[model samples]
Target chain A: MAKMNMLQAINSALAIAMEENENACVFGEDVGAFGGVFRATSGLQEKFGKDRVFNTPLVEQGILGFANGLAAQGTLAIPEIQFADYIFPAFDQIVNETAKFRFRSGNEFNVGNLVIRTPYGGGIHGGLYHSQSPEAYFAHTPGLKLVFPRNAYQAKGLLAASLESNDPVIFFEPKRLYRASVGDVPEGKYTIPLGKAEIVQQGTDITLLAWGAQVEMLEKAAEMASKDGISCEIIDLRTVAPWDVETVSQSVIKTGRLVVSQEAPLTGGFASEIAATIQDECFLHLESPIERVCGLDTPYPLAHEKEYMADHLKVYEAIKRSINY
Target chain B: MAKLLNVDNPNNTSKNDTLNLEFVDEHALAIPTFKMLDDNGELYKDAQASSMDKETAIRIYETMRFIRVFDERMLAAQRQGRVSFYMQCLGEEAAVTGSAAALEDKDMIFAQYREQAALAYRGFTLEQFMHQNFSNEKDFGKGRQMPIHYGSKGLNYSTISSPLGTQIPQAAGYAYGQKLKGDKACTICYFGEGAASEGDFHAGLNMAAVHSAPTLFFARNNGYAISTPASEQFKGDGIAVRAVGYGMKALRVDGVDVLAVYEAVKKAREFAVENNAPVLIESIAYRLAAHSSSDDPTGYREKEEEETFRANCPIERFRRYMLKQGWLDEAEDEAAKEKIKADVLSALKVAEKVAKPALEEIVTDVYEDVPLHLQKQYEQLKQHILKYPEAYPATASRIEETK
Candidate 1:
């Protein structure tokens, strides 16, 4: 095991996937020489050669469309959108073509091996253009799996699993945690199966559910709640679409309260889905209405970014509200 | 007089080299449309002839006739309410069939919705086409897709999508894969001139050129996108000139002439595979049918204009070429048409009577294996459908079947 940041883990995962499978390749704008804007693909082009890891024309639709074609041809394609904010240009490719390829073709054809990686969420002060968390947009798409890893350890494992998956995965790496969050990730290959939530902390007072960078915030909030003699269970939902509702429901059934936190806007976010599902599954056991600590519905702001973002304070307040109720 | 900023600095001055500047008149930049045969079935003098053999010429002529017959029969079926929707490759047969004929079996085809002629040329059977259109249990796509959106893994034809221009960039990537494999194979992407207005067109071509992907971007400038005419689509010198901006080779062919389209595409394919580069071929054809069964030509077009294009019908032009070559006889052509029409009708009759897909298929193939959530959703849907048998009689009836 080695201590690594999310960027390093992602780069290692790409390299490992490419080393294992000759059909695997990576492409995006500035992914080659520049090693990606976040350097998540640093040393990849040099190590894998330009053919296996190369730059593409700066068009998100083309990048994703090409990835679909590559995957359809039995090549494992890892195409990156520079940021989640720019992925909308390729939304049609994901929704209409990539997502529908297998279902529409009746299993005769599919871009199953395509993995689209993009940095998402706020905290980098990237203003509106760079910091928008659009995981909810893709989480709504059925055929596409949405994965967001909180730190290096989870990022590497989930990414490897996504690369090996026989389905298109929209792997959103929380840009806020790219370098900020570090952990002891295994130097060798490991995989964390999608749709499995990891309970990072154990508590019976209330359950705190989150994914991506919000998991860290929730962990901090859980610590704060513990100081107030309020025990909080933290469940990091690695995969948003096929989330481990059983784990969450079980946790909620034990705790009798739920506090879902995410960096995305409260409306139509993946957190809302979790909150709704928990309520349906464990309604009678609930001690309080499901609380959601999320970003404001407005665009990610430049000025007073902290106020616009959901931090530990907001999550702590939601925890208190749930515990009090 | 206004003084030029930084005029005293010689380095800041603009270079005035009019002598070296060569100007191309806008008219000169207009693509030269190619034609191998005239409307009267006469070969144009000094025109380049197709290298196609007599057998191939006869095959192309028959395929065109088969498509025309198929379209006529299917359109009649659609009107009869036997099929939900249909899109015909009426006058644009040469644009699809000829180009498909020119390609090797290994080459991939990424087609727009109207290229049924290409599928037909690639040995997609009448039964297959009928099953897909009828969306029967035997339909390869399992009734998930609409009519005319056909695909076959064996045929190497990517399934067609209703969204315009999505396949254009996909061809580039598939060809890039072929280039990586160092295979002699390439990919041919078909779309209409109107689809060229999409951003994907620019991105696909630019990527193909930059990556030196072995892809042939075949644009059938078939007059209209639904009710919108090509004249209203762009002011440039058609879709062919746009290829030059991407630094790719391009050709504009007379789409009514099968030999011309075949020759152009054959050469384009060779160049693509040989140089590992992309080539664009713009076939200027007319939509001789309504955009689809959902459209009515009278809403936006004139019968006189349709008749003018009908005079230069691609299938007729190819038939005339075959007749001149003595590869086709009038009696044999009529017999072929009758046989195809009969076959299409028979297949339609059989396909329509076929049962709908298994109700379980509604949840299957969403993934390799249906996850638990989908299983639960399917179970709930089954219960709901069973509860309201009158509203979902077809589904309720099939709920008990093991298949």
Candidate 2:
């Protein structure tokens, strides 16, 4: 097992997938030569050749639509939309067509095998446009599967599985944690099941559900809470669409109290959904109403970096609120 | 009479004494419109005209009737709120169905929003159309798309897109693939004249011309883009004129005349396959209906103006010519209409009644498999449905039934 950062792990996965499947091609602005704006797809163009891995014109819609056409015609096209916030130009392709391709064509035509690999999330000083968790927008659409990997191991495993999937996937890597999170990633063509949850730590008192950059935030909060005797059970939901209900349910049932956390806005955010589920599945088991600690309901604010993020303090606050309740 | 350009047929280099019009030159830029079966429903003394028996002519007419009837029924369904929205190609049937008829079944099509006639002509079942309109489980589209955006792999029709001209470039690229494979198939992309204004249109046409991809860029110049008429849309004569600038073959056809459209497209498809060259066809036509069910055409265009277009209806014109030829009679026309009306109505009823796709489908196609967070999100929605039964009563009822 080789220990590497999340960005390096993602790069390794892209390299391995392209090496294994001749059909697996990656295209985006600055993805080739420059590696990527974030270096997640770094060194791929040189390794795979420009024909296999290259840069495309800055038309997001064209990039995605071309990818869809290629994927439909039997190529595993993985397009990078550069940033999560900038994906709106290509939103229609993903939401209206790519997501719904299988269902819309009555399964007669399916490009269920394309991956839109994008770097998402705030916390880095990238500002409003560059740093957004637009997973909610994708989650709102029916046909799309959403993935948000936390660290190196999950990044490589989940991305490899996504590339191999016979469905269109939005593989969102947290830009903030691209270098921040590190873990041992097993080499070779390994795949993690898409809708499975990983229990990072066991706890007897409370279930802390989170993912992506927020999962790292939860770990820090959990460390802080442990000093005060709160055994926080942390569940990292690596995938967003078709998420692991069984894992979340079991954890909530065992812990009796649930605290969901995310860096996205509080209202209609990913955490709100998780908190709602706990209320339904383990309402009887709950010692409290499920509490959610999320980013404030506002456009991600600039100049208020610490105030905007659902960091350790917010996670700890939510845990306290759930415990007290 | 306007003096037409005289030049070589850009689509075909063969030296023939076809009338060289003003629009053409020795360089062969103009698109040659062919009509072996004249408007008088008489077959001209052309050696290239295919032998079309009464059966084939009747089949074509019946398909046109079916499409018109289906469009009318869908409009009614939309009015009843059984479906959300609809766009009817009421006056432009020949441009769609005729081109579809001219091609081999294996050839691919990339359509803009209004070319439902292509789907109908290609044997996309009435049930599939209804299912797509109503978004039922039986709908191959899985109740996921907005109404009228039809796609069928079996028919080789790339799904219709809402974005104007996006399919144009995509078709060119797809045709490039076909060229690379040395396949007999060419890609036919249909869009309205309004969509031709988008950059994708120029890009697609220029790319196809440069790459020598087998593609036919069919522009249905229906005279209006919602409220913006062609005069305001472009200063050029029509979309056909742009083909010359791209150094590709171009044509202008009496879009109402099904025979002209059919003959032109047949030769265009042939040229595309043989030389890997592209063709731009400007179909001169009018929109006899509102842009969509939501649009109020009376706000922009006069009722009398629309009345004039309705008078010169494509179906009516084609019907008259077909009847004059003694190929179609009153009885057959009525029978075809009655059968299509019944089929469309029955399919609509059946399709509307079918259940919507399961909620699990919402997350399934996003990846090769459902991811963890999405599973959680799915469960959360399920839980929300369970918890707040009053808010989503329909989903709650579905859940209860599933249980």
For candidate 2, give fnat to 2 decimals.
Answer: 0.00
Residue B23 deviation, candidate 2, in Å?
Answer: 18
- True lDDT of residue B35, candidate 1: 88
Instruction: Write the residue-wise lDDT of candidate 1 on A121-230 in tens digits.
Output: 88864555668889888888889898989889999999999999999999999988888888898999999999899999999899999988889899898998889999
TM-score of each: 0.57, 0.55
DockQ scores for all predicted structures = 0.02, 0.02
* TM-score of candidate 1 on Cα atoms, chains taken together: 0.57
Looking at model 2, residue B118 earns an lDDT score of 84
Model 2 ranges with Cα > 4 A deviation: A1-325, B1-53
Q: For each candidate, what is the lDDT? A: 0.85, 0.80
Residues A175-242, model 2: lDDT tens digits: 88888788888767699989888999999999998888889888998998999999999999988887
Any runs in candidate 1 off by more than 4 Å, and if so which? A1-325, B1-28
The clash count of every prediction, one per candidate, is 0, 39
- Score residue B265 of candidate 1 by CA lDDT: 93
State the lDDT of candidate 1 residue by residue for B267-316, as single tens digits: 99999999999999999989999988866777557899999988888877
Against the native chain B, each candidate's TM-score is 0.93, 0.88
